[model samples]
Target: MAGTPSNEPNEAPSSGADSAISNEKNRILVSDLMGDEREVFLLFNGSEYRLRVTNNNKLILTK
Candidate 1:
């Protein structure tokens, strides 16, 4: 089968269309998550964490 599709788990996407679809659905802008704020709090599994934008414009996450 010279032109058959692959069902292999390790196969890369055949075209930009496949990658673009996944990128759009799974990606989020950092600006949207931290709008007009330098810090945001996140909670997971009954624990709290802090996400901060440093003065140097780098991100820091801490528990």
Candidate 2:
């Protein structure tokens, strides 16, 4: 017999690092980073990059 699929909604899997990072106070919110915009430009090590929130509310960073 085959196993049945779960009926519960899928959720993001949590890892040890996720718990540790959530407990730390040195984190910044994504909303704060975007600041009323869906995208932001970042300059790191003399290279420019683009950070943006996708339509599905996920973040994407590109050079």
Candidate 3:
């Protein structure tokens, strides 16, 4: 028998992020977290970094 529906009030699931989100940075990248794509930055200093979340749900970080 199916117990009370999961949506029962006062009985919600724990708060956490979905694994579907690409977390390769913590699982792959070994650099830095400069900023996201929507940020505005001038190309200067020793090196420039950029983070992009593509429409295909892909996370790309470049320097």
TM for candidate 3 is 0.29
After TM-score superposition, the amount by which residue 10's alpha carbon in candidate 2 deviates from its true location, in angstroms, is 22
- Candidate 2's C-alpha lDDT? 0.85
Alpha-carbon TM-score of each model against the true structure? 0.65, 0.59, 0.29
Q: Order the numbered candidates by lDDT, best leading.
A: 1, 2, 3
Clashes of each: 0, 0, 0
Candidate 2: regions farther than 4 A off: 1-25
Model 1: per-residue Cα lDDT over 6-61, one tens digit each: 78555455687877787689777879999999999999999999999999999999
Q: After superposition, how far is residue 37 of candidate 1 from its true place, in Å?
A: 0.7
Best by lDDT: 1
- Measured with C-alpha atoms, the lDDT of residue 22 in candidate 2 is 69
Candidate 1: segments with Cα more than 4 A from true spot:
1-16
All-Cα superposition RMSD per candidate? 7.7, 6.4, 12.7
**Candidate 3 deviant stretches above 4 angstroms:** 1-45
- Of candidates 2 and 1, the better by lDDT: 1
Error of 1 at 49 (Å): 1.3
